[model samples]
Target chain A: MRTAIIGAGQAGRRTAELLRGLDAEREILLLGEETEPPYDRPPLSKEVLLGEERPRGLMQRAAEVYEAQRIALRLGEKVTRIDLGAARLETAAGECIAYDSLVIATGARARGLRIPGADDPRVLTLRSIADARALRARLRTGLRLVVAGAGLIGLEVAAAAIQLGCAVTVLEMGERAMARCVPEAVSARIEAWHRAAGVVLEFGCPLTAIRPQPDAIHLVTGKGEVSADLLLVAVGAIPNMELALDAGIAVDDGILTDADGRTSHPHVFAAGEVARIWQRGAGRHVRFETWQVAQHQPVAVANALCGEQKPYAELPWHWTDQYGRNVQILGTHSAALEWLEREDGGRLIYFGVDPEERVHSAVLIDNGREATPLRRIIAAEKPIQRNRLLDPSVALRQLC
Target chain B: MAWHDVAPEGEFEMDVPKVVQVGEDRVAVFRLADGFYAISDVCTHEYALLSDGFCEEGKIECPLHQACFDIRSGKALDEPAEVDLAIYPTRIDGGVVQFQL
Candidate 1:
């Protein structure tokens, strides 16, 4: 059995490692576009950007792990085309590798800035190691920074910059920051946290243009003109589904996959941010762009390969460390849900309850303790009364 | 030290685990279909209280990351958690639960 995994990321590397253990005789090839080993992407905007940790610290496994596993790792190589009919992959180096099974974990790329002056040297995006290195070089104390988005990446960078004594300003087109991922009250708490840490947030403002000056960047917004030493664009990411679409695989907002990560084509599987997985409980399809989802999805894919049909269903959880704060989110909450807050010391627990009074999702800021019970409550669909949830005097265990 | 004075013979439910703090030790007391058992309330993976976790069958699921542990032996079920929780001796005495610290 020959297996070829595209994009040497967390999902792809995990799949190759599992396959090697399952069938040692089976040939496995892991192709990575990056020259380095597979590394964690979360720290790029935090530790790496702040220069607190080196870029090499992000590597998921040591070099010996790949060598000992007897997995073929192709670095600095790009897969140009996937011949689904021929069961082969064409590489940029002019190598055709035949495979019995192919896994597409191509992942997603940072959405590039399209406005004028986006090509300037001061304009940056934090997605890969190279981007982090470049951003770190320019991140000096007392420098002014203009961040174009208030999403996770942007907020993380802003927080790091503020800690470094940089005057940071964040511009968000939405009325509230992280509007897509978090509820309004939760966003308000985060907004207040950032503001207290010396971050200037300008909401409901869109940048019209970016003009590069000799010493600063002049950003024209609907509110007013702002000058900064650097500009960071972190609006969002676009799924890399071109190869899947060109290969005749069904593509919606992302490459459509069943519960087991099986694509429309046999012997072809898709995982990570590029695949739109079917959420069994929700009875709908969703695309998750987080490290936790990426780590858990490969298990279903590997199980499917071994002839075991297992549905992929894990409550989505993500964590972010910014400005000495640990923020964790679990499950998904709608706009109609009510918010309940419990504050203990520096920690804040925000619970979102549905119309049936069931805990739908939760957000924890500096509170790993509260996150424990909240995770299970969300998973069990436990109905937590709003008043009781907001009361800090009552133990969370008693509520359960 | 009498069995009848510790706890009611069948007051504990199979589904909900009761939390009991004996001296300085926090214990989670559960009554399964087979018998009653007691384990430390703290999760081996994190500082989570095991009594707050959901109880199903004979296993207590850690609420933090959903790591399951056997109530009888107090052994961790899977990855992300590789340590076993502490088990305590328990008995029923006069309609009350008496756990040996």
Candidate 2:
């Protein structure tokens, strides 16, 4: 059988690797729109922005490894159309590639600002290595950076810019920063930390207009006008589901798929940020823009393609490093769960427990050691006592 | 290879890993259900200390990205970590745990 995976990001690369691993004789073709090989994305906003030199060995696997595995990598090739009836894909260069199985791992693109003057070439967003390098080149001592959104990417860039001696200001439309993912208390603490680190954060103020100049970019928000040397609109990301949608595949915000990444078509599958996977726990389709999902979810899809059906049920997790502090979150955070907190040493850990005293989610600040044990504890689905959770003497592994 | 004293055996708790700086390399000494095993303290994928990771079932999981490694062989057993860690031979000398460099 032949498998063709489009958009060779983490998800696509992993799916191709796993499929090749399962069946060595299978013909796998991995197509990436970018010229570069599949490289890690988490470091693009963190270490790449903070360090002076680009880190070495950024590729997930060397070309020799791919060659040894017989995974044909077609870089800089864009799949223009997917003809489901013909079981083939049309590339921009007028090449028709036949496939027995098709996997759409197109991922996502950085959402652009919609306000007037937003189309200026100077307005930046960080999504790819090129974007990171461009943004890093502009970060100099005494430079003014105005970030539009206070989400994870925006705050990470703000932290990096502030540490790079740039006067940074973050504007968020929501009342609390990272309100969509983290709890209010966590966002408040992060906001306070950013303020202490010389970052000016403005919440509940949406950017109304932007005017680009030779020297600076003028931004007008609901609060007032601010001029900066650079402007970054880190609003969010939009899934690249156009090909799947044009092919008549079911899609909402992203390409719809089952737990095993099976789409409406029998021969077609989807994964990564472009897939709205049907999560059993959520009781609805959910699309995650997390590195964990991109790296791990493809295993299930690959297995399902090989005739072994295993559902992807891994817990959602994401972490961010800012100003030497590490913040890790596991599972979802919502007001419906009761929040509890405890401090051990300088690390603060928060647990979101349901009314039945079951740990649903957790947020750890500088508490890396407890991550796995707490994950097991939450996965065990056993009721835990609040006192034991708050007590420092009790080991988390024992509770698991 | 020369043996170097890492820590006293009394200082180690069961199923816990202790990191010690030996020469220019950091080694993580684990006291598992069987005995003691030593491996490089750093994760192969990122800049995280594997000593801060969770050790269970003869395997250690990186705290940062959850990349798992076999403690016995220092083999990377999961995603995000493709390189295997360096494993060092360990022996109990007198009342201390010693690992070879």
Candidate 3:
């Protein structure tokens, strides 16, 4: 049997490796829109943008490893359409690939900035390796970098640019940074860190339009006008669900998939950043563009494809590195949950609890050490005694 | 270098990792359930101190990016870190923990 996997990012490459390991005889075709080998995505905004590291050996496997694994990797090819009934995928080059089982790991694309100067040459988005290389060359000591969003990617870029001696300003529509992902306290601390680093952070100001000139790009916002040598639109990402939608697969923001990675179609499956998976206990759809999910989700998807049915029940956990500080978050928080915070060794740790005082999420700032055990605690949804969680003497292993 | 005294026994608690200077080398001395084990304090991933991190199940997680290193083996068991840490032999001399500098 042959397996065709679409979009060769972290999820695509990982799933290919898993499928190859599971069954050697199965034909595995890994397709990617970009020709570059799969490099770690998180580092693009951190080390790579700062020019501290080169883009070498960033792949899941070396060339030799790919050759040894005998997996067919097709790069720089876009899937134009997916015919679910025929089980055929049409590529941009007019090649119709037939697969017995298909996995749509198309992942998400960067949400674009829609304004007059949004499509200007000076404007860039750091979604690919090319983008990183381009932005790295443009970043100089005196350059003014105006980041459009205050999310992880945007903030990370700001930090990298500041390190390069560039004047960085971040404009966010929301009142706080990382509004969708992290807790308010965490956001406040990060904002403070950015501000203290000489980064001009303007919250509650949304960009109205951009006007690119020969020297600098002019930005008009809710507050006032600002100019930039180059602009980065790191607002957010929207899932690449059009291909799935064309195939009549149910897509709501992302490719909707069950716990076992099976989509609406029988022989078709979805995984990675693209899959808005129905989380079992959470009773909600979750689409996480995390290293953990991309690296681990394939095991369950591959298992189910091979007739071993095991659902993906891993708790959502993510981490970010900024300003030489590490932040780790397990699960997520909404307004419904109660929050309790503790300060350990000058580090702030916040725990999100349900109405019954059951721990639902944990945010550890500059303290990623507890993330491993804390992930289990969140997954278990165990009723956390407030005093025990706050006590430093109490070992996390014992409490969980 | 021979065994150099670093800290008093009472200051080092079980499963509590601390950083101390053994001559020139910065060492992370962990008092496990059994005895004391000393490894390099600086995380192999980032420059964060392992002493400032978390410890459990014979593993010391680097506070920087959660990269876990086995206390006894000094091997990095997780991602963002692939290098192993240097381990120094230690012994309790009198009431002080002396690590080989």
Candidate 4:
């Protein structure tokens, strides 16, 4: 059997490797739009932005490993069409490839600013390796940077820029940072931390216009105009679901997938940021753009393709490191959860408890050591005592 | 190889690793449900102390990036950590824990 994976990002590479591990005799083809080999993206906003690590160091694995596994690695190949009936894909170069099974892991791209002067080369977005390299070159000491969003990417870049001795200003449309994913209490805490670290944060401010000059870039927001040497639009990402949509596969913001990562088409499957998988806990299809999900969902997809029913239903966890502080969030944020905050020494941890007294989610600020035990407690899905959980003296593992 | 006395049996906690400095090297001694085992303190994937990781079922998950390693064999079992860690032989003698490097 021949299995073909499109978009050789983390998801595609993982699917190929996992499928090869499951069936050694199966033929696999991994195609990527970029000429470079698959690499990790988490460090692009941190280590690569600070110039602490080289680009080659971000490679997912050695180039020789793909060849050694007998997996065909095709680079610079963009799939333009997918013929589901024929079980074939057509690349942009007009090359047609047939496969018994196909995976659509096209991923997503950075959303662009929709204002005047937005088309200027000075207005940048961080998405690909080239974007990181270009931003790294401009992150000089004493340079002024104005970021147009206060989301995770924007705040992370602001932190890195501040460490590089750059004057940073972050503007957000929402009242707080990461309003879509993070709770208001956690957002306020992170905002205070960033403000204390020499970052100027402007809430309720959205970019309305932009004026690029030879020396500096002028960004006009709801509050006023700010002049900076560099301007970065870190608003959000748009899923690349056109290929799947054109193939008549189901799509709603992203390619819709069942619990097994199987799409509407029997022979076609999807994973990563481009696919929204069915989440049992949420009772709906949810899309997660996290490093952990990108590395994990492929395992279920490969297993499903090999006639195994390993559902891709896992608790979503996301961690962000900024200004040398590590913050980890476990489980999905929801209104049904009542949050309770606990302080251990100097660290802060927030637990989201449902009406049934079950632990739904948690937020840990620099207390990653408790993640494992807390995860076990959440997975048990049983009623928990509030006082014991709030008490710092009681070990979290004991609750499990 | 030389055996270096690190700590007493009472100092080791179940499923917790203790870091002991042995002549310019930091070794992590883990007390599993079975017995004591020693491995290099540093993570193979990044600059982190494995002693600070979460230990369960004879496996250690790095606190930094969540890379998992077998505490007994020091074999890396997860991604982002492709290389295995160095392990050392350990023995309990007269209430003291010692490891051979």
Candidate 5:
């Protein structure tokens, strides 16, 4: 079989490796748009921003690994279009590659700012190794950094800049930081930590425009106008679904796929940030943008190729390390539910319940100790008493 | 055979692990439904103390990175942990817990 995998990120690399391992006789081609090899994206806002590690350190596999696996890696090549009827992919370099099976892992790109001076040289977005390198080169002490959006990436960049003695300010239009992933209490804790680390937070504020100045950029916001040496826009990301949409495949927020990573079209599959998978537990189609999901979904896709249909239904878990603190979040938290906090204040486990107070999901903060046990409890659907659940004297194991 | 008493069994009702000094090594004693088991307190993966972790069934979960280990066999359960812990014989006579190292 001739297989062509697009994107060359974690999901693309995993699919290529699995295809090579499953069928040695098959010809595999891994195409990446970036000039460099596959590198970890999570570190772009952390280690790369802090200047603690280089972009080369984040490569998933060395060059020799691809050579030894006999996988043809085509770098700096962009796929212009997918010829679905002919079963071929046309590249920008005017090369057409025939493939029996194709994996679409085009991933996502940062949402660009659309203000007046959006294209100014001082405005930046962190998505690839090149973006990180460019941002790092411009970072200097006493430089003012205005970070739009207080999401994970924005907060991380703010923290790193503050640590490097830069005057950093974060602007979030939302009521609280990390509003999508964490509870308000957890957000409050993180906000406090960031304040202690010298990051100025501008919540409930929106950026109206950016005007380039002689030495700095002027940010026009609802609160006030601010000047900064660099402007970082980390609002969110948009999935790269143009190719998939053009190919007439289903796309809602992302490319819609079954649990086995199979798209609507036979012989075409999707994974990574670009794939919107049917989440059985959540009973909805959800898209995940985490390294764990990218690493895990390829196995299911490979199994599906072998005639075994297995759905990917693992609990969504992710961790972020910022300002010397390890923050981990598991499951999902709803604001309507009651909060049960541990006595030590080090752990906060939010319980999601229905009208009858039946536990549906749990969101734990900084308490990896209870993660495995909580997973089992969530699976068992055991009824837990409200008072007993909040008792710090009682071990979490006893609740099980 | 010298059996030094470490902690009372009731102390483990709230949490399984109770750190105790046995000879020169610091050991963590866990109380499960079956019985009490003791192992080295320090995590083989990092400098985290095993006694501060969450215990469920027969496994001790690392508080730092969530690496789980079987309390009896001292074998690591998953990734991020490549080394196994050293297990020591533990027993409970009456209400007192003792370790045989």
Candidate 6:
């Protein structure tokens, strides 16, 4: 049987790994748009942006591992078309490949600033390794950086830039940082962390235009004009679902998939940021562009492809590092969440509860040890006992 | 390698990892439901005191990046950290916790 995975990101790499494990002799082809092999994206802002490390360490495995496993990695090959009926894919290189099972893991693409001069060469986004390589070259001590958003990527890049001795300023359209992802309370706290570290955050402001100059880049904002040596548009990311949509596969916010990652077309599946798996807790299909979900969803997809069925119901979680504190979000992060903050000695844990106290999520900052058990509670959606969850004397594992 | 006594058994709390200086190395000694195991006190992802990190279910999540490490085996459990921690041979002698450096 031949299984073809399109994308070559974490999801594609994971699907290839699982397929090899399930059947040693199955033919597998992994296609990626970028020339580079599958590498981790989380460190692009942290390690590679800071010029502290190259992306080599973030690779799924050494290049030789692919040959050893008999997995063909067709790098720099973008799958331009997918014919679900024929179970075939056409690449940019004008090569057509047929497969018994196909996975659309095309991941996400960075959202661009559609304002005037937005296409200027000085303006960049932090999505691909190429972007990171160029950004790293231009970033130096005394370089002024104006980030367009205070979301995860923007704030992370701001922190990394500050560490590299660059003058950093972050602009956000929302009233607080990560407003869509975390509760207001969490946003305000993290905002303080950013400001305290000498990073300037201008909230309620959005970039209107970017004008390139010989010496500096001029950015027009709601407040006034600002000139900086570098500009990064980190508004957010949109799922790359065009290939699936063009091929007549279902798509909502992302490519629609059943619990087992089976798309609308039989013999075709989806995973990672590109797949909107059915979420039981939310009672709707939702897509999460998180590192944790991208690393895990392939297991269920591979199981179903191999005739071993298992629903994809893993509780979503992802962690981010900023300045010196490590913040972990378990289950979900939503604006509608009501959090109950607990202080155990010096550690802080926020439990996201609904009106009836049904636990929905939890954010643990500088206390990731609480994550493992907290994940179990969030996955079960158990009723919250405020006192028990608040008491650090009581281990979170025992509470569940 | 030589074993050096760091702390008494009573000094450690159940499931709470403590960082103890053993000559030139800082080690995090964990007291689990079973016994004790030791790993490097430094997080491989970044420079952070692993003593201040969270420990549960025989794993320590780095306070800076949340990179988890299995205390028993010292294997890195997730992203942002791919390097396995250096786990030292540990044993308790006469109510004292000791680790081989």
**DockQ list for all candidates:** 0.06, 0.52, 0.40, 0.45, 0.26, 0.45
What class would a CAPRI assessor give candidate 6's docking? Answer: acceptable
CA error at residue A180 for candidate 6, angstroms:
1.0
TM-score, model 1 to reference: 0.80
Most DockQ-accurate candidate: 2
Q: Over the stretch A216-253, how does candidate 6's per-residue lDDT look in tens digits?
A: 99988899988998898899999999998898889988
Candidate 2 residues B30-82, lDDT tens each?
Answer: 88878889999998887888887777899988877778999999999987788
TM-score of candidate 2 on Cα atoms, chains taken together: 0.97
Supply the DockQ value of model 3.
0.40
**Leading candidate by TM-score:** 2
Tens digit per residue, CA lDDT, model 1, A112-196: 6788888888888888778888888888889999999999999999998898888999999899888887888778878998999
Worst 10 residues of 5 chain A by lDDT: A52-61
Interface RMSD of each: 7.3, 2.4, 4.0, 2.7, 5.5, 3.7
Q: Tell the DockQ for candidate 4.
A: 0.45
lDDT (CA) for every model shown?
Answer: 0.81, 0.89, 0.84, 0.88, 0.81, 0.84
Please list, in the order the candidates appear, how each scores on TM-score for chain B only. 0.83, 0.93, 0.90, 0.94, 0.86, 0.92
Give the residue spans of candidate 5 off by over 4 A. Answer: A54-59, B1-101
lDDT digits (tens) for residues A156-231 of candidate 2 = 9999999999999999998988887788889999999999999999999999999888888889999999999889
Model 4 misplaced stretches (Cα beyond 4 Å):
A55-59, B22-24
Evaluate candidate 3 and give its CAPRI docking class based on DockQ: acceptable
Sort every candidate by lDDT, greatest first. Answer: 2, 4, 6, 3, 5, 1
Clashing pairs in 4: none
- For candidate 3, the TM-score of chain A alone versus the native chain A is 0.96
Q: Write the per-residue lDDT of candidate 6 for residues B1-101, one digit (tens) a residue.
A: 88888789999888677777867789988888888899998878667777777676788887655678899898999755778899998888998999988
Q: Comparing to the true complex, what docking class would candidate 4 get?
A: acceptable
lDDT of 4 at A251: 96
The root-mean-square deviation over C-alpha atoms between each candidate and the true structure, in angstroms, is 6.6, 1.5, 3.0, 1.8, 4.9, 2.4
- Pick the winner on TM-score between candidates 1 and 6: 6
- Give model 2's DockQ, 2 decimals: 0.52
